[model samples]
Target chain A: METPIEGIQWNSLGFSQTKTDFMVTSRFSTKIGRWEDLQVVQYGPVDVEPASAALNYGFSVFEGVKAFRSEDGSVQLFRPDMNAARFKQSAERMNMAAMDNELFIDAMCKVIAANSRFVPPCGEGALYLRPLLFASNCQLAAETEEFTFVVFASPTGNYFTSVDRGLRVLVTETYNRSAIDGVGFVKASGNYPATMLPKKLAIEKGFDDVLYTDSNESRFVEEASASNLFFVRDGKLYTPDTSRKTIHEGITRASLIYLARNELGMEVVDSEPLTVDMLKSAEEVFLSGTAIVIARVKSLTFENDADQEYKYPSYEVGKQLKEMLMDIQNGKRKAPSSWLIVDVPSLPVQDQ
Target chain B: MVQEGLYLESPREDLDWSSLRFSYTKCPSLVISDIDISDGADGAQWSAPRAIPHDPLKLEPSAGALNYGQTIFEGIKAFRHDDGSIHMFRIDENAKRLQRSAERILIPQVPEEIFVRAVKMCCVWNSSYVPPYDSGGALYLRPLVVATEPYLGVRSSKVFRLVVYATPVGPFFSKPEGLAVRLVTGFHRSYPNGVGSTKMGGNYAPCMQSMAEARQSGYDLVLYLDAKGRGLVEESTAANFFALVDGVLRTPSTHRKTILDGITCDSICYIARHVLGMKVVDDEDLPVELVRTAEQAFFTGTAVIVSPVKRIGHEADSEMAVICKSLDLAQELKVILTDIQFGRREAPEGWLTQVTPSDLEPLT
Candidate 1:
């Protein structure tokens, strides 16, 4: 018998498509009024109404979490429970139907075990997991209807380009990502489109992405187009307060704060309104997300009442934070007990 | 099972035209206008369009259109002339509006030429389904652009699919009567910062609950107040509202406001001012006081056309109301619009696009 694992380049893979064999799926049957049991099916398209609320009304919410190969031969998940909780919370805010935490965990386990072959070797890359929930029932009227939940996996390395190149961002107060009172805090799909035009304008000016300010005044920081934001200055951390405004309170951002305070014994300052001047004074500015865990910001150019520019010469804090978070994710260092969910069965591929 | 090209109309089909309702019926052919987008690019570049057989789209379960709510659409109507020729009403306006919607939400814009051609293709292929000349029904066309890329990131999709399908349906209001509406204050349908003017998918989904609630309370639909001002009347669930007081036509302003820039509302204003030489006033002020003096009120949309308002009621209690006894002007406007639509009267320049005949006659 010939070994089937040839001609695959795992480490060189960028953030792109590599369809896994199966996808775990579930549906919120408006009939039963709850998420159904997870089922592993071949990855393909599903039939839907042309007027499905997910399409016509933007009633879609989702979460992104990653899985990695541990030093031992066992598969692992890094706090998938957090992603599930966020998805449930987002679905609720969007008036979408969602599943319970237990069902979410069970589905993840089944999906990881089913696609264990695609999990890259240690230090190569991680399997990107995407959990999505959307309205499927089609009607012109505005009523909450049956929703569908699906999870698909892809093997990828970097979300952005080379990690060493870092990022150059433009801060535009001309447009706000989300209204201060809108659905920005939730992982609502509708919230992202508002950023595309701003990012496009910034790209024309030779910038990588755009950072939005508060909608009302454009004074305080909100978030980047793709991910939540974090700044380290004078040994203190700062991010937009999600409780008051529409900032995506990401799990990766949460983990870094956890490490800054408990692991490294640093005072983390956040939830207070953060100003651009404070960010300009910061030693290092970077992003935190499940995709590009941490990427330093080389420069920030902004125009609110007037034009301003800020540059940083160091990635010290961003590097340290990335190492600490990756250590916890990749099994190189011990994680806080609540941060890892590792009982997923690692079924051995006997065919090889 | 639907046969090839027979999905539109059948010669042996049993039909009742008078009782036809506004509904979804499968068209035999679907026209597509699309573009190809790649990573690290600023925007998409649309390519040549095509038409395919009508069927449920094969979408990747995690397509951005499904999970990210990346959808924008346009509604158009095609009327059959007395001589059996089809004339589509104001398709170019819908095309321009669709592009605006695409830009606001970052979906690929359908070029006006491609949009019109695609719409024409769908209308021609489904020509058999264009309700009879005097059925008082127009074949409703729905054109939608959706993100088709299979991805997990909460960003604009790299690929998009533009599809247009036709549904033969009767007029929104079959009789020469008026509708009952209520003023809703509880939930603001949209904000000044929100994407309300464009025909985006998110704009429609949130209003369903409000509309359903209004329907159960013995009202046709609910009118929303602007989120920014909270005093200005914006729009009803699916249409734009206009108040006719004395001799002037007044309604909410959509310029910087969050309300939709309704094409029907635009056409109505155009006809009133240019064709009929009537005074027209467009403002965002609350119509509360004017409701008492308004001789007649009506809704203007592609679906509703010019549906007169029988009365206006409070959101909390439908019993509290202001009633309009006559709909003379409303009926007059409807006749003029429908007359031009069905080709009983000549339309202004470029208002109609004739659907040239072809040999593919499925109905025969």
Candidate 2:
């Protein structure tokens, strides 16, 4: 077994980049019709053509996954297959070359194993894996002929710096995350930049993040800036329907829904439109994502009417679910064989 | 003026300039500048622009541009005058538009003077690439800005890099005389509160699929309707739309906040009113039905100067309207625009900025 790296303040880690040791990279071109030259190189800068579609036309997509160091000092990843499948969908939507799921998972494992020392000790934090794919040719037009795929790792702690008393979120009608028929459902790079301004404004007003609404009517709540929203009414759980194509199908959100139905025996409703009124009356509210495991919402304010606010009196549901989820992640509780990848495949001898 | 130690290279002699197509041909040099928001009081600490060799950029794998799409760009053209001098038309407008795009995406705006200087320096350093006055080709300048800070969070980067490069490109459309356009429904380019009007990289990639489908169906371009489903004409994949109806020139208003404020479109409206003495109708919603019955229609942009529309097809309705009975208006506008661009006719004040080549002596 590999030893944890020295000189890392794992306990003080935050949701920022802490460079690791190695990264995996590959290239694809229309001429070759397949990904090639896969290599595990030192983590650093990569050369990119100035006129490449990745730079000129914003042709990029990415995925996020985390690897945890369990109680026995063994490292395991959570739902890497889900991230691989979603990465493929995002790549296809942006007109980029999609990497095969097997190759994607293998690369993730190889990168994490190469940097096993960076994984925090049990209960400290996790090593976050980022898989990025983009068009990488020097072209002036919209179509791309060459592509690049990269997977890099960063050790990070909780996404929210302060979450003891829950978070104050603002409902925004001034800006929309994405259009109805746009790339909201996909984890395209283009979908995130537009939210920066809205998020910054919310923070200035003493809120943690902005909860976006649908671009068509601004009536139904879509999701937060970076994560998916979940509401608890009485004893039932409700979330916005991903079938509307305006909300991202988050892997964490799906896992929680599964746990809520199978483990907790709670009635989960996910196919309904989650409006502001429905959310205001919810007994509890929380967000879910790879970066933010689960965060409780204490209050919500509407942008149009600052006088209007909704406060949640209880966060018991979110706290209970976070513990259950973390237990499975840290290998303390039993999980489906497919959910936790305990035996990470070693790097190929030739590649190593 | 060319900086010391930054000598200009001779124009490339390998290709037939007359047969060049709308594509990227590498030049010798490009101008670049960088800004680090932390270094300044208001996040406006921009380094002095410098000319560098045309080479690939070194970026971290997790750069904001690569991860969150914090990228914006502008497209302008430079013409070779009859007197063997290169000049850029309405470059200031491009500089201003780029600033507006930067504001929408939260990137710190590059001051107009810096933007103009970088573009001019890039053009002058690559003056040889400008096509001959009669070759009907020009040097296309692409000014791009991207957030280079390597971060995982979804916020504007405190660091950005602005680059201005030149590429020799022929006319944008193969058929410069006229083009066949298709009106696409059910696919919206920009929503009311989205970043549609901004010339950011994110706005272009989403429309590639629609453009490719239109090409497969034998159409030169696709026209989009408003995202709100209001049935009002928006714009084409790359350019703005205009039509001539009952002796009046009409186009969509920029106030809708869903379409780009095209500089070429602005110029055409001015020419139509002052030069041609025709009634120009801007600031109104242009419905598709009105354009179908119009006498003529065309597209205007920096790349496509003025491409007359011959036919517009809507497959869902099986409607194919022949637009141009006489191409006199479009042809006239194109000639006037080209004349001013190529220095054949007198230009209005501040319309043209000549890239002085005295300091860019060819290498011995």
Candidate 3:
């Protein structure tokens, strides 16, 4: 029998941990030299060495994917293959072992089947899946060969509460998230704590969060604290070209850019870093992520010598793009060639 | 009185104790006052600590420490004296440093009393594993503070865990000729206004690539410079660097906000001023060229005590020094510190703390 999905207020849910019934875990030991202990276990703590490199050294990487209940009753995943591809690239940078796409996709499908009842209704929210890979050897030095890989799911709502009201952002000139030519491009865990100092300062100043600049010059706006940025100007959608620096290549941002240029027949520019003035004078400013989906920006508080305020006209373009993406995600419109995967069957009963 | 939860486990008697490396051993470590970092909950800083078996800790996949690198740690050692008594060197300093590291990452700070007591308990329980003073092995104690709150956001964790463990390891340098180091001009350890000073996990993890490069080319470790200039000598991958220019001893000042404040580095500077009667200057621009022109150079830390510099190599430039066994001041300082540590010589007022049986008792 399926898990009874009762007493759940899916519409009123916030971005929090709900402790679903199951989590998929796997491990790799240096002595054995192969992946072992792969199964769907209870959603609880597993054995970890207190001195593991993940605890003493910043030696871990993770990815985020979302599963949505489509217009049909079947549940589907949005760009899970992209997440797996990026996970492999990130692990290579951190000197960790890689899990091929087949295992990564198979694990996601199993979790969706096992927790098929927990998948929310078509319009409420999606199941957020987090996959974390780390160095699990207990040592002080950085030469760790053993590692652990795990995947867990949580029911989450809008990342920013104000979907309609938009948000205020602080442009931090003093602090940086990561140095270019460093691990900035990779979604390493250490990169998050490095931004808490600047984010705290932004919150204290009554702003939503911070916008980090390049580490050396501190002039060009690289990215937001947690998400990627996009701006619309002169009938063109533009984002920073992260070909060289340490900006995260967001999948949502990539999909929207593809739709705009290929289908909508609009010009999409992946050009230079979006300056503070470009964002101010743009038609619309927005943030994109697996969690933030697509949210419009209201104003920017440039915290340089003098705190100057820059405002955009409206969020018409942002609203349209969000609807376009959600239409395909909810299966209201026919998705492009290979965007959505909707073949997960409901799981059967098990002997607990 | 014996504590209720203290596990007085026997020591291991496996072969090849002489060939032990500085890594995790099978000895049981002590864990204390684990605080859970929860959402909207003001977690306690610490709880009653106890001795536990050395095994894997059960953790969720979304733990803040495992996901965001919200972890910090300290390293110290327990030395066995000539009379077979064991003590720790400046463990109080390690406790204070752990607090600074916790603040940097927003993890709960382990109380100094709890932190110091945990280290002592690990040493007391594993006393048999301490290498003999003549064999030159020391029982290395590792104190780790990690965040364990299960959340998916990129924020600081509210839950935390503290662990202290002991392992017996051979000395860093067993011969007279000291370590050979290469200057890594490509990679950078830390930048300005970064968490370089704090003993956080992020500071050490990024340097693994450079350390691997050094090992591939037959060098001990890599030497780093200011990431901007790639010229000014910062420090080695693990230890701090010092050069003897003129008659004064010089190390990179923490005011530069780049060098980590090694306790061993600080203690040796004290002996230089008060015991050796030499003028020490920590406030000097440490240029990479100083290694070539300076009279002598060395590295210092808790693991590698006063290691003399035998050679410094960059891409094409390599500087070698004469093996002056008699004129090396670093050796003299190491001997004085070791003598005091081994109970063969009287140390300064608050240098070492003897780990007694009563110190292992759990607090009521």
TM-score attained by model 1: 0.85
Give the root-mean-square deviation of each candidate in angstroms.
4.9, 2.8, 3.4
Candidates ranked, most accurate by lDDT first: 2, 3, 1
lDDT of 3 by residue, B1-364 (tens): 3565544323346636668666666575465558764554454557777777677777788888888888888998888877777778888889988888777667677778888888888787777777776766678888888777787778777777788777787667665776677887666776666667888887776777777778888877677887667468888767988778777788877765667888998898988988888898877767776656667778888877888876677545535332222338778888887777777788788789887766665477
Off by over 4 Å in 2: A159-161, A337-342, A348-352, B1-11, B39-43, B319-326, B357-364
Worst 10 residues of 1 chain B by lDDT: B3-12
Q: Write the per-residue lDDT of candidate 1 for residues A222-296, one digit (tens) a residue.
A: 789878788888888777778753788899989988888888888888668888667778888888777788878
Deviation from native of the Cα of residue B299 in model 3, angstroms: 2.6
Please give, for residues A145-244, the per-residue lDDT of candidate 2 as tens digits: 8999999999987543456478999998888877767678888888877788888888988999889988878889999999999999979999899876
- How accurate locally is residue A210 in candidate 2, as Cα lDDT from 0 to 100? 89
Q: Between the candidate structures 2 and 3, which one is better when assessed by lDDT?
A: 2
Query: Tens digit of lDDT per residue, candidate 2, span B1-364?
Result: 3455643344567768988878888888888999988665383766777779998889999899999999999998998887787789899999999999888888899988788888888997787798877888889999999989998767788889999888998877877557878887657777777788888888877787788788888889988988767778999967999989988899998785789999999999988998889999999999887887888889999878898988888666766455577667888999998898899888878888888745344323
TM-score winner, 2 or 3: 2
Highest DockQ: give the candidate number: 2
